[model samples]
Target: MTDKTIRHIGAPASGRSTRERLNPARLLSWVSGYETLVLLGVLIVVFTLTSDRFLTADNLQNVALVQAVTATMTLAVLMPLIIGEFDLSVGYLIGFLVMLEAVVAQHTSNPGIIIAAGPVVGLLVGLVNGLLTVYFKISSFIATLGVGILLSGATQGISNGKVIFENIPSSVTTLASEDFLGLSLAVWLTLLLAVVLFYVLEHTPFGRFWYAIGGSERVAYLAGVRTNRMRMTAFAAAGLIVGFAANFALAQAGSANPGYGPELLLPAYAAAFLGVATYRPGYYNVLGALVAIILLAIGFNGLSLLGVPFWVQPIFNGSVLIIAVLVARQETRQVRTG
Candidate 1:
């Protein structure tokens, strides 16, 4: 038979063949995966139903501003995730960066470029993390967790257990307060970064290499991909983004506290993991992370408006992360087995 005839012959059996062929499996892989679309739909339905206040201009403005820090950090997390590594240091790293910026702004004569220092410090920290994980052959989780502990101690020692209330440079402040059109500066920055990250993850050679390595390090290495370098680079990139998030958050609060970083850790991680469950269900990607962040932010924000207690936020974040990850795992397993 001709190749074309063979292709037709291999098609699924008749009743609703077209629709069945487009079953959850095919659709999931193409549309990122079912998890992502389901999350998107859920967000839309919740917003539409719960509070007319949920989708209003002001509330959306709030959502963008509120989730900016988490979203930025989520992008940072995306790289390591794609390469199948996890960096628990992001939360503590942001905390340290925020505190460092505040302290530097107060003591240094050159507070003008102090915000820029955030990313520089991040790069350095990321280098340390990468080296430990890649060169020493330490597990990424162990290395990052150790680094996180060190950072927490360093931050506390530096501040002498005091909250940093220094008057940061005006430039930093503008990042939080300034508006671009109708959105806050942070929101605009988040959107810009998201676009850049999405392009890199979807279209760039580096992104393809990262994903390849993530799918199977051994296989990717056999195919001539530099697994170690890819993993290291992913961690470093995550650190830089975490630094940006730290600076943005510090400016938003106009103060730096040692505790700020850990507060964001759960939500940041939750968002990143949840992203893996959606769009691409079994895989991690930038757009999936962004969508996860948005959905979590909407649910949390909506609950807050409905007079939910302060402690409820953690409950919501934790529960959603666990559930999303579980669902993602199940779907992924079925895909692999069937």
Candidate 2:
């Protein structure tokens, strides 16, 4: 093999006609990398054309507000995924924390303390999950699933198997109502989290270590990457993010429900997996996850505007998740076989 790398191995000479330059493999690769992005554009165009209200500023802001929590959870889950592990309890963690947040608010009107409760607990849960998976050698699926079930039961107990709407202070309840430039605080907070994570993952050695660890634990360990510690840190970071998500959820709804957070599990995971199809393609990424969240949110908003049945959401999310996995697999293959 030559030392030089071909720009596009499948492409013919540049001197060839423009038609020859438009090779199928190149096109497929491009499309695969930006699958969600392309779909997002298509959806926007379709919905804008079909529904008179779809492209309005008010409706778009509403979409942003509605998707803020899902975006946060999706971002939270991306940490464990980047390190080549799963945190099935991601959903339940949010559920438990939101209930906990409500309880905190109920007992104390201090906005600082009330908001702090969620992230603190979230960090602890992540630590416990890390202990089970990284230290005890338990499979992540089993460990996080166990934690998730425990959280589910705890949420039920905390809220008495129902949503908590009473004793929530006016300050706590109106947190999400604060807006800047027509967008809610929830939207701003989620975007802030995304930017921070993006920089950490893309511009720092810490991020490189994570990617190395994800590539191969054994290899990263042999290279003195402290695979176990980093893996635990990943889970912990994920928990911290979920904690913020809980706060956002509580702020937006002005009430805490036992099962509300858990319901977003499918869409959250869908965004996380679909993230692999864009931005940094062939691997899990923060930016990709954010984009995926917007795509899912817009898709849902468009469908709802078209008067689709409530049942269509699950099917739509499930199909996107499956497609995301397939696209990710193919992109990984391309990266490897190249």
Candidate 3:
């Protein structure tokens, strides 16, 4: 495996032409590849000028905390996307898991067991998703959408259509209460997850294999990569990741509410797509996702400070997602044409 070579589908997405390196068009392409950063800067400047609160410490901390769960969910979305699969169930899945955690907390005084159940059950959910897509040959979108819907109902049923908040241990809440170096432990944990994933996806042989699979499943299979198994593993791993995030979320809120999952789903996807158009261009990378997450966080938080209506967030997210997909396509096309 070490001797094998796996080519990325978007290796040249960020590569600029040396012949006309300074040409306006070339420069634009390069800039567009990193437009998320530029957009983030613009949003920061605009919001700072527009609202005095934007630059304050309290507001900044709120921004980070608000996007913390989305940041974690973005990581969950990244893994399956790298393998060219979509897990639409993620938002619902994680939401359900959080509710489940609250239920566990209410039922037992054993903190460790309550916390431990999240990832374990999440892993099983991921496996089910894998089974649907791999063995059953269902479309990834359909399979995940169905799972998400099912979980939405399950979340309501198990929690009796009410919020869950009782006997959740202080340890669970520590993730939100504790902060080191000006960031919550949950935020630090999210960053750590991003870094670990960056390594696994960019440095490890497994990462290369994933790129190969994303590039072309048939080609990877012919090259001796266990494509199906890897795809399944990706979903399962994503679920496990989301499970941990759900726990952090449960810790932060110390409770769970129905309909919490769907709200983040669109934003997570938007951030993931924006990531595709960021640092690595057409490749879905953790670093890119982080930037995109910050970009979205700033944009959404800024808009809120402007006193916009609640409907604006979804509109903004939809618009960003559309723009991100277009940019990613352009990057991919540029490389393909070259």
Question: Which regions in candidate 1 have their CA more than 4 angstroms from the true location?
Answer: 1-36, 109-112, 308-316, 334-338
For all predicted structures, in order, the TM-scores are 0.85, 0.91, 0.88
Overlapping backbone residue pairs in candidate 3 total 0
Residues 193-247, model 3: lDDT tens digits: 8889988988898888888898899999999999889999899988998898898
Q: Which pairs clash in model 3?
A: none
Ten-residue stretch with the least lDDT total in model 3:
1-10
lDDT of each: 0.79, 0.85, 0.84
Model 1 has an lDDT value of 0.79
Ranking of candidates on TM-score, top first:
2, 3, 1
lDDT of 1 by residue, 1-338 (tens): 00110011244456666777777765544443445567657776776687778768888788777777888888887778888888889889999999889888887736556787788899889888999999999999999999999999999988889987866777787888898887778888888998998778777888888888888899989989888888888888988998889778877888888787877776776778888776556678677788888878777788887778999977877777888889778767765675
List runs of model 2 lying over 4 Å from the truth: 1-14, 29-32
Lowest lDDT block of 10, candidate 2: 1-10
State how far residue 288 of model 3 sits from its true place (Å). Answer: 1.5
